[model samples]
Target: MLVLSLSTVAFLGLAQLADASGSPSTGHRRRTAGGGQAMNLVRSAPNSNEWSTQQWGHWAKTQKSSLEAKYGGAGASGTGVQKRATGTNYMTNQNGDSSYFGSLAIGTPPVSYNVILDTGSADLWLAGSDCTTGCSGVATFDPSSSSTFRNESSPFSITYGSGQAAGFLSQDVVQMAGFEVQNQIFAVCEQVSGGLLTAPVSGLLGLAFQTIASSRAPPFWETLVTEGAWDEPVMAFQLTRYLNVSGVQTLEPGGSFSMGFANSSLYTGDIDYVNLPVTGSYWVLPITSISVQNQSISPPSGQQAYAAIDTGTTLVGGPSSYIAQIFQQIPGSAPGTGDFESYYTYPCDTDVTVALSFGGRTWSISPADFRLARLTQRECLGAFFEIDSGGSSAPSWIVGDTFLKNVYSVFRYSPASVGFANLSAVALAQNGDASGAVPSATIGSSAARVSATGSMLPKAHRSAGIKIGCGLLYATSASLLITIAVAGVHSVLL
Candidate 1:
């Protein structure tokens, strides 16, 4: 099926600055040597059946058309909004369906709010009391209820594939995992429309650099580093996936987020670090090659080859022409019918190996991760899809979680680099099984019930059982009940 995206326009202006400096802006602080915290990252949409390939196909088509119209030009030098992951994770219900979610706290007394930890956009926002559309059935934040709330009076607005949010800037105490940052900057959405109400999600927590942040404020992770919350200056993610005894695809609990430090225990071997361009937005990287089973495919050259490493997006998207080459290699794969022209279908059991090359290293994606879903018992959709790049101004690809899941990833703010390592047995658990020993839940206990639209914010604290050694507070939670409410597809499926 197709995919949707969150688009940003500011990254265009920042690319030039980065090209000259050989590095991104150095305003961010370096992590203390060997000091950092860890947090568990959960699937934003825990209920997977709430989404459909058909629905995703429709969303992808609409998003492509929107991009073409918005950025199409000859030799357009400005950075066009490629794909905004919108900072969402998905999970599934019974029968192998999926959605992903995470938890955070806001305001005084630390009211818990469920959020999608997105690496796409760089903003943190939640629905406020003033939101009229797509605000029902979900939790909302009331400024009056927060003791630390402060209004900046600056208006804010954001656009996504299926919806839009408009609100005002505000400041309050924000706590993620367990680390608390007082007077953190965020947005209060007063109005929302389109597909936001489809799922049970409170809001999105952007994990990208502050350059692309709408508030132009330091994102939560950056602030955490600046404050020396951890012993190291790195944030690591270990995403887990599994094939259950019933052959049902499921997300395991091994997924985690480590702040201020990269846990060597989670990954095997050395982390090959790569320079991520300071695009003033997403973690943009250069691509040297792409192939499937040793068959190389040529991606769009020049500006198009700069790919964005986004965890918010569910699919790997790029120009339709390039995607066609990859799809052609899959047996039984053919053009999708009706609404999903950009998508392709293949046999569910097809054995395929997709490899992506960057920074002189090739990372491979197995058939299990590349296969999006089983349309029937025999037909399946591929996770890699075509995204119109408006000729050439857009990015060559938006590397989503489909690729990120296979590796233990580290996103560093200062020097702006992205690193990847092979997921080890210690990091992903035995054979991708989550039934082993449970880590001690590190979430702190705090009680304050605010509005819950699609999912309730659990008042209990959780952790992943990682010790900071430096005696710093770790944000890794061992037990976090996350309910991801995706708007567009959820509305259609539910």
Candidate 2:
């Protein structure tokens, strides 16, 4: 399992500034250009977290579309225009057989091998068979055997807050739906370790739109948009844990990822969109504030930072100090005493309210979502905040399902502007809950639905780990060793 670490907090913090104040001239605006709302592309710095001076110029040179356009509306045999396919099938791997994969087709030959569909990551990756791996469960793609394979050895690596994976860059002919694209830039992990290999997927297919793609390549989703394969550059997802269990499923061919649009019924029409500031090459956003129970807390002043809004992360993470302050406000939240500083807990039954103040809006999380998991009695709740020894100074945060459950988020990026739309409660109700939990089916399949049931971790294991860690830490401390030993003895006697 990927040990979701605290280092991601800095990245999240940087992305929160998507709407920070900036000059209209310097930021992306929804303007009528080229007869339509042309998306203005912003490039991140060459080797830093800031946006670079080269904006549209760099994108124009590097951007590749996955679709081809036809003139007019082409019928089955007519010469009218038809749009090329831009999306691909995302899959899951179970045991060792591709047929047993979760969301993908059982018998379809993979157009692109070693593909990964990850909720905890924003970019897709594939490994060519030639790469290196000392670990197990790694799949390799034989590009030569596939008629749609293309290689572009750009050499890439993505370092998460918890660990790092390196691989070579290559392009291959990829097919999904009715679309076929040649030479797409994808990464291959040559050496991967630290439990990430255990995931049931071969590689990563990031669902987050292009805005947050790693610097090595253009986002796969954005590549399709730029090619005019899509009418708009927008994508939306309602992920339910159990429903997504198999992982090899694909969206219906004509279904909309719904780029640049919001389902108004899910939330209030009050949309908070921000212009990203160009700080070097990276597009950076500033987080103004964070809160718990609707009470706002001040962040480090004058430290203008940028972050990427990532859908791949499971929890909101940031710098230790910043995270510490945020968690401090929660009534029963506490730090872990283990080698991994990324674990936290709280009373299961506590009615907690956690909110993030960003882009002039307060995004709140309810008690049900804040509680990591329920105990055997289904009465106690566990806290979800994690601290990382690696993220002591970086100002980043990953806003995952914990907070997204209460809102309907839409991500859009075109030449005109890149922003998100929040929908109203009506839409949310129709889509079920935003929390990605599996619903109990007291009824039959027709009435089955996803429901919130707290965190993924089992309560018993959590409690045991906490007890053991606390016992060890307390027993080793000079001031508490004797006292803890005495308490242990006394407890045994009682």
Per-candidate Cα lDDT values, in order, are 0.50, 0.31
Against the correct fold, how does model 1 do in TM-score?
0.72
Residues 1-494, candidate 2: write the lDDT tens digits.
Answer: 01121111100000100111100111232222111211111110111112122321221111100000000001001111144322212111111111111111100123322222222223445444664652243445565665544444344554332223556555543333222233445555565433333212244454433323342244444455555444456544332221121331211111012322333433456656556443211222466676766666676343323343433323344455776666677676676433223444556556778766555566666665565333323233233443232322222443443454455545555432224445444434422122322110010010001111111122232211110000000000111111000000000000
The estimated TM-scores of all candidates read 0.72, 0.55
lDDT of 1 by residue, 366-464 (tens): 677787656677877777777665444435576766687788888876667888999887755533453532122223421111111111112132111
Where in model 1 is the C-alpha error above 4 Å? Answer: 1-37, 44-99, 197-200, 227-229, 242-254, 391-394, 430-494
Pick by TM-score: which candidate is best?
1
